[model samples]
Target chain A: MIKVQQPEPYDPLSQVPLVPPPGHYSASKLERVLRKGLFAVTAELNPPDSADPRDVLKAAEPLVEVADAINATDASGANCHMSSMAICSLLSRAGQGSVFQISCRDRNRIAIQGDVLGVAALGVGNVLCLSGDGVGVGDQPGAKAVFDFDAISLLRTLKTMRNEGVFLSGRKLTTPPNIFLGAAANPCIQPLEWRAERLAKKVTAGADFIQTNYIFDVDVFEKFMETLRKEGLHKKVFILAGVGPLASAKAARWMRTNVPGIHIPDRVVDRLEKADNPGEEGKKLCIELVRQMRQIEGVAGVHIMAYRREHMVNEIIEASGVLADRQ
Target chain B: MYAVRLFCTRHARAFESVYKGLEKVFLSLHPLLKGIGYNRLERPVAMIEQMSKGFLFDCKMCGQCVLSSAGMSCPMNCPKNIRNGPCGGVRDGGFCEVRPEMRCVWVEAWNGAKTMQNGLERIRVVQPPVNRELKGSSSWLRIIREKGAMKEASKRQLDPAKSELAQAFAKARKLEPAAVPLAKEPVAALAEQAVKEQTSVHSTQETTSQ
Candidate 1:
């Protein structure tokens, strides 16, 4: 890992660390918002391919006002980019809360365990554990795939570090990390009946929240939430539905065919195809989904992944009016 | 191998009972195995394990066998090697995201588990990461040795004498197993070779199935 020194001296007034409220896991704004029973929104930051700090700030410019916390992806889609840890640190320095995403595709247990402490010390508030894409899916297929820990074990390791104050090997730590833990879910995938059970396993392994894959079929997602509600898992962990703009009918079809685990419904594509401006129609669809999802019994919030349509996020959020009542 | 693997999963209930019976046999053979020397028996035991498990499940010999817990499916065959539940990348038809032609191992495991008695309970256990050190070693030998030692210790505890046999057993428990080098190649190299061999074998099976 490349060590980038903190560029400037600390300005305490810019971002004062909040003390965790009673029974709160971390001092994350997102956690506080969720616990308050208010809808929370998290947006993914487009990781810059270069070392410039301005690129990070520029990408975060639109999302800083609307999102409760920004997510820094770790080489999502198995493609190389600036590391999530560095982006988190930069975001933290800029007084914005960031979720540092860690994938088990590249790093072993030793590296991940050490990173838990590193991100915590940097004032990052949340860690999202993911079983990342395979190396074969990436540009660099020759790279060794080191899945030393799957998402469940990764969640377990972090839980051990935070709650037990020890490493996976049982070595003691002076100060355990104080951060919220999250795991990803795909409610639209195969073996739909087992999806809720899998989430149960994740919650048992110490997930504080869950963010799911893109949801185009609300009926299927509703069924998934119904299962979770029946098991009473919704009360255990917060769930944020993944929603995103489709750019155009062509883009929606492309994603349906190429992206794994993402099931874009035929009606959605037909809706996009009928619109004169599919890009605007896509944003409208996202905003509509956000409004609809908030009315669901167990949905805590929406995770809007705009991808290249990042510029449209603020518009979508504002139009959705999900956060209208909040200051 | 693919057909056999699927067949085993479909009959996972019967295989579970068979596996339980074999475990008993292996435990009972511990005395003879110990006399012949476990260190010397590693090669022969590992060879037999590879031939049997390899043909059945295309096993990668991860050494820390969780086949029973995984619904008789070998998780090491997963492209990302996820041991818990299925990843978020299973294709629409329950195929693997990495290897599009192959079924997702966890999907098969879930189906297989549905056929077993205690399948749901067993599959829910969160498995720890693979101990890379245990790769290429014989999981059968490891399980047999561990269970046999445990049984002997319990028997000693039940004895009224509470004599030298108990004390000797207590002393032996703390000692590490003898360091027997099972592979001439580095473990990482061996792992890579195993993966390559699996891919080739799978390709051949794919062709034959077609």
Candidate 2:
């Protein structure tokens, strides 16, 4: 079994870097597991809407043990919450590794580049670059959408800082951030033939790995993987298939209608409706997806996004048994 | 206007050829434009450009126009103003998540690119962020100036043994001794080179590890 370590003592003001083992891009355990050719699992932490540090700790306590790394989202859905940097700071202070997500919808290049150095100093090793949801989808519709950089440009900028030791403006840095860069993809979206090409663009822009939007249709997802294989992208980066548990058929239907990129097949919702207890059935479906994803040729792991259902992640991972063979 | 914009993308090749012809006209008129003073003509030229391109492509005049590279569809019209490519939130049926009534700009760009001579390849370029300072300016004039500068540089390179006045003027301006070749390189070629460099870096790391 993979061993869980106790939190080490840390000073919040320190800017010292965590030294990775030789040949690794980061000190992240997720990178270590993936590099060692073992199935890795990552989970998203629902940022609490409160200022209390205890709330952040409570939400992350369960995930720290099960997830290879915890992801702190940056104002996902354009709804304001505890800032992702604060959540990652709390996790890092507690000696836990976290993925610091940066969305380009709210910050310009200057603000974002500064935050990268801040997170890196605080011991964050993985960074997820996203274009973020448009501000119109949020509680506040009047906010400005400052997409100074899209996901591809964001990835490219971060990669330049890490490797070339310079910012986008060619300014030299005293010490560059050591990061494992990642980008988001939606494989089940429209104009299906062009999805893989878009992913290829992201890869060329400096994405070391990819986490897709929620996948409820294995058939369509398999087709996406086939395209990646044909382009030989699978050899260049790790691909993590995103899966989530539904609360009920009504909730699934609502998501399919309201959420921007989510695609829930009609049969899956019908099966959830036919079940005696839809909540329990949703967990079963998620576990089944994990098993099936593990068998896919190019899939490196599964990213579970159990929003508001964080408690079920432990049970879902245990039941899926992806880490059963690890020691 | 929307239908007309769609028509322009459908006939992107025709528009491209038209732009090439217009570029030649602008090039030939450079001496006259300089004589008239570009600063004095800026407002009138900008007004004319806005009147025409606005009617045709609903152009926002971001001033660094990439209409030819983007399949003749204006990227500034995207709700997010994403210049690189489509955001992940494009809805089913290829509609905009933010503006469901309208189709995704990148999707139209892709379709328009398919009919062009090199549209598919050109569309793959990762565009840099828009320069907010260039808003409401005339991209046509800017393109003409850039092309004129390129031509002047090439002429100087070929006839280095020819003009002392032009050479002295270039020295006074503190320009680079030679213009960067990147100004004339295809963006897609640079993107491919970046991918190759990344793969070579990975292979070198593997060799050292072994």
Candidate 3:
């Protein structure tokens, strides 16, 4: 029988019950990662559209052994798919670490609160609070977008829930989610300048760690890190620069044009366009970004955002050489 | 009732400029269009607005036009019609989780707002849900008649305790007036400070226990 602690004094790490509850994941690998001083690698795991647990495990198989934690994206882009919560439950049940994504795009306050309790109950550890993708860009344009709390607010909310052991409504929780809180940053995104300051804001809102948007422009990412360093924001949080393998030069160019925050330099596109094997070149570039990001001062880790094609994750990381001391 | 408070940012300044420019043209043409009052061009105007906006920003003509607030992207085009920021479904490279082929509209809005110089205002404002009655209306006239600012343009009163929109409004109200627009970052700093204090206290307690 699991005993719930009373005379409740909330400690963020008191998440693990004193005794093992039947079968459960060991610990939050992502949490044990010492910020700034240590290097870690996490991968984005896109949950399957089906309810099958094997499908979830199969998708996670590649990175599970390598990544410190695999992010289970919630209904990203407001498109329907498997829920991030389910993926977290399944992954933890399978003894894998997960960063359960909680988006403000769909759930209201009540739902968000319930999910926090639910994840905690399931023994899930890490959570990435996102402002969520706009519903206007999703498959269901007709559905109402719930910005119950934007990323910043969600971070604050989760922090309060854990520390105060109370809901945003001032209601107490029998057991608070002892999560290692994380928030996202889009360093490369425009107005081209406010990105770093925004990251600082995420850290300010109680994000212990940050996972950024794709880092296509090394110069832009470097500048954002510089801003964080200048502000001493680097001392406040662990920043993991986001990196992904681009498909081709054409895709890179298309992304620069049609995509909002992504900015691919002309030279990279030209490099891809000129390459006999653009796909292979893209992987090489991905490796290069990882190595370069590691050299940056503020970046403590890397979050590999490999959408749909997660199979190549190990190969890409191996090529990047970021797995030197990863557990 | 959803109270969509619009905090004016640099993008909103551009919106004001466009509104004035359109008003000048519309006022000059109102005499001409109204001269043929029986055959008003409302339908044609709506169609034109719909077509041009659809092509440019996929405008949904949600009578309370948030184009400027959303960096000229039509909030209606989003599956959830979220105005404040993005959802978790913001896939890699800003792809829409719902429509992998498409780019997330909020992502575009963030870029647009940034490019347009609404730096401090990004993700700070919370847009209220669309009023179905205002569908297919001219944003030009709506701006002139009701909300001088989108913040004032909200049509309903919200209960903060009961709804998310109300809670958002309460939070936004606590920030400095939108004129400063520098309000959001400091508030974020305060929240961060609180967390820091709590963690330090927790560590001290753990040490004492040991």
Per-prediction DockQ: 0.30, 0.25, 0.08
* Candidate 2 residue pairs in clash (backbone atoms < 3 Å): none
lDDT by residue (A139-188, candidate 2, tens digit) is 89899999888898788778878887877666779989988999998998
Residues B16-116 of candidate 1 have per-residue lDDT tens digits of 89988998888899899879877677767788989999999999988767787778898999988898879988887788989999988999998888888
TM-score versus the correct structure, for each prediction:
0.86, 0.86, 0.63
- Candidate 2 chain B weakest lDDT stretch, 10 residues: B173-182
> What does candidate 1's lDDT look like per residue over A142-249, in tens digits?
999999899997898788788878776666799788889999999988878688889998998889999998998999999999999998999999999999988999
Residue A213 lDDT (model 3): 78
Query: Alpha carbon lDDT of residue A233, candidate 3?
Result: 90
Tens digit of per-residue lDDT, candidate 3, span B1-210: 011112222244465467457866765554354355412444566567777655655566664565655665555666655555554345556656556676666666666566454434634454333334345555443333222222443334222342332333343432311211111111111234455676799999999999
Q: Candidate 1 regions off by >4 Å? A: A1-19, B150-210
Q: Backbone clashes per model, in order?
A: 0, 0, 24
**Model 3: how far residue B85 lies from native, Å:** 6.1
Over B1-210, each residue of candidate 2 has an lDDT whose tens digit, in order, gives 788888899899888889778988987997788688666766788789888999999898776688876788888888888876778888878888899989888888888888887777767765656645456666776666556656676543233322221222222112211111112222222234454676799999999999
The CA lDDT at A24 in model 1 is 85
lDDT of 3 by residue, A120-186 (tens): 7776778898877656656797888776556776776677787777776656688677788899887
Interface RMSD of each: 8.7, 9.1, 6.5
Instruction: Label model 2 with its docking quality class.
Output: acceptable
- Best DockQ among the predictions, by candidate number: 1
**How big is the positional error of residue A164 in model 1, measured in Å on the Cα after superposition?**
0.7
